[model samples]
Target: MSPPKETNNKINTAKSSDGTIVKAGPIVKREKVILHIDGDAFFVGVEIAKNPKLRGLPVVTGEERGIVSALSYEAKALGITRGMPIFRVKREFPKVKILPGDYHSYVEYSTKMFDIVRRYVDDVEEYSIDECFGELTGLDKPLGMSYRQIAERIKKEVNEELDLSVSIGLAPTKVLAKVASNWVKPNGLTVIESALAVDFLQKVPIKKIWGIGPRTAELLNRKDIMTAKDFYDKDIAWIKLILSKPYETIWQELHGISVMEIDSAPKTVYSSVQKTRSFHPSTNDKTFLWSQLSKHIEDSCRKARHFNLVPRKFSIFLKTKDFEFVTALILLPSPSNSPEILLPLAHAHFENIHKKGVLYRTTGVTLLDLMADFVPQDDLFGSNAQASKFETIHKQIDLLEEKFGKIVIYLGSTKNAIDHKAQDGGTDSEDLDKNLLFL
Candidate 1:
């Protein structure tokens, strides 16, 4: 049986004990100006930055994963897309150039881009490797430039110093800023004032709203809410009742009300840390499979330590050639981030899930239930001393790696995975350090 649609009967007015009608306080509106800066094909842009000759040519990255991770606008003009198999691209688009991903260079460029933004605006949110949101409210008079002029200056500086193209959007809120940034492609600048937001939102489909997924878009379509303006036109109480809090926040932003604040703080705590690697040519050799899993554990633990965190539980998984996952979760006796402590437990569980002659293509480990490693807590069995000793050793190892590069001193178990050459003649795996630590 179909259930009845939930209804909201709440109103803005209320009755006091004295039977007097009372109305809610007047709505307070705040003025906010946000800018979203997005890179145009960031990974490919970095490659072109290194060698200007690659510009105006069809180029792609992700040679390591045998898939198209990022492609230039020129390549996109030929109908190539992200996640398309490299083999297919070579066969169909013979002239398209494919390059291995230089994640280190990408991270360097990303840092420089955000740093440049911070020089203009102190409140900057590093949204991703290629995207960021900056607050520019009330800075017009002090900075001696309008919001649009500030955005243009930022874009110009980034282009001149980094030799990369960026699209920028200036709007009243982050959601609106994102929409404006994406309005034009490659290198574009768009501004959406609060007064004219409806005009801009009228042309935006519900699916185009940030954080709205396909399923939500389908549901909204069934309700005859087709565009951003349609969604914004709904009653606030009705939206709160029908959708989740996040969507309600988006609805508020669509109306040019600054409901979401810009988070400019650095991320230090995490609930979980995960590291995974997918290699070419599925292998059935038990030793090699264990080596891959070991590397994942080492990488995850390294990140946990960098954040001064330790995990009390973890899970290991292996992906078969047919794309099936076999996983095992293990709870530790105590929270720890030492590879010496995790390797033994992971290997024992790996044996239980490792099927004979079953080829596997990926291996991963996830550290869960993390907490600050301020003080070592000893279990009833009293293993704190041993754990402390390993902690000290890892601190030194981390120092060496920081000075040199990652994996300066890895566990012997990861030797096989580290030494093995890439069968596809690409990178062995993505550098976890560069991919994870962006601060």
Candidate 2:
């Protein structure tokens, strides 16, 4: 006989090292363990990590032009929300500490955080810049510690070494682990074993379950399935009738079945890639604006090359100081990731869309309609040959930059863009010619 289709079913199982193969009555459904660790107030924490004095103070980062990107817990407590304009924040909370974002340092700390996680478990997934997933299965024996103990140790090490708090969750599946990790905030750890899964899930609202977005949650709510427990209580056949593969996978995951495995590989493909930068005090200079757009285009091209992708189309945009926005789109002559070819085309469209005397604060470039890098087709203008030559030169430039620094070599048009005036009244440049780091 099979387990009950309409209720919380329990089956008697013959326990094995692998945790499957049930015997015949009530048993705990066990599955592989996953641990998810997420940084607390990541950008703000990075700033605090650099200056310990910023700790316990209300901190916010962003708005070289005018919007808040991130806020510390203290600032959040004071009702300072992200995306809120800094001028409003100044008026409401004058004591709030505002700083410009340091993406370079943030990347450094992100690498350190992942490296620390890798020390504990080799199968670590850098889920995001400030989050990671570590497979905890089979790590118990080699480490000589229980899964929860290992998680706690990882948490402690991160705090002691990075001086940043992390919220960690350990559970049978990635979805559940994410839920557990988010259940508590800012230095909390929650472990959900198979036996405790249902009880814990029962308390969570249907909308709170990972992977179930608002539309799906609303659909489930209409059916009176309002809690994780309500979704879990449905039989397999009933779930199959209502949802497709991904939601079905989430259902199985909730039932202690590891349908999704940990993926350690970095993402290789992107539908679109975008790069944007905000300028301080805004500018109406056409040359400076084009230079900023060129910088963004080059940055986007570099990212595409990293993923071995080429875009068939490109979109460029300018955001004016008065919040007016203008955009232009172009179909590439052929799929390409070379800024040398793309930037000139971008300039052609920028001239058409850019209105004179508009104080623009931000410029952005987006590469779209991407596909795997492929050989370009011959065109009427026969730019293929010139494109190939530019491609070869860019490869050499890429190598030099990789060895020396990202800004070692640059196109003349983007030279002014390279030495960007910092929002905080400083000049931020990555010119290794000025200073080099031995490490």
User: Which structure among the candidates has the greatest lDDT?
Assistant: 1
What C-alpha lDDT, on a 0 to 100 scale, does residue 64 get in candidate 1?
Answer: 77
> RMSD of each candidate?
11.2, 7.4
Residue pairs in candidate 1 whose N, alpha carbon or C atoms collide under 3 angstroms: none
130-233 per-residue lDDT for model 1 (tens digits) = 99999998777689986667887899899999999998887888999999888766677777766667877899999999999999999999999999999989
Worst 10 residues of 2 by lDDT: 15-24
Model 2 per-residue lDDT tens digits across residues 1-439: 6553353455443322223232323222235779999999999999999999999999999857478998999999999888999899999999999998899988899889888888889888888899999998768869998776787788888888999888888888898888778867878777776666787788899899888999999999999999999999999888899988788999988887878888888778799999998867788889888888987888899889878899999999999898777999899988889888898899899999888878898899999999998766655368897787777777777787788665465566776665554334554664422532211
lDDT of 1 at 301: 95
C-alpha displacement of 338 in model 2, angstroms?
Answer: 1.6
lDDT over C-alpha atoms for residue 379 of model 2: 54
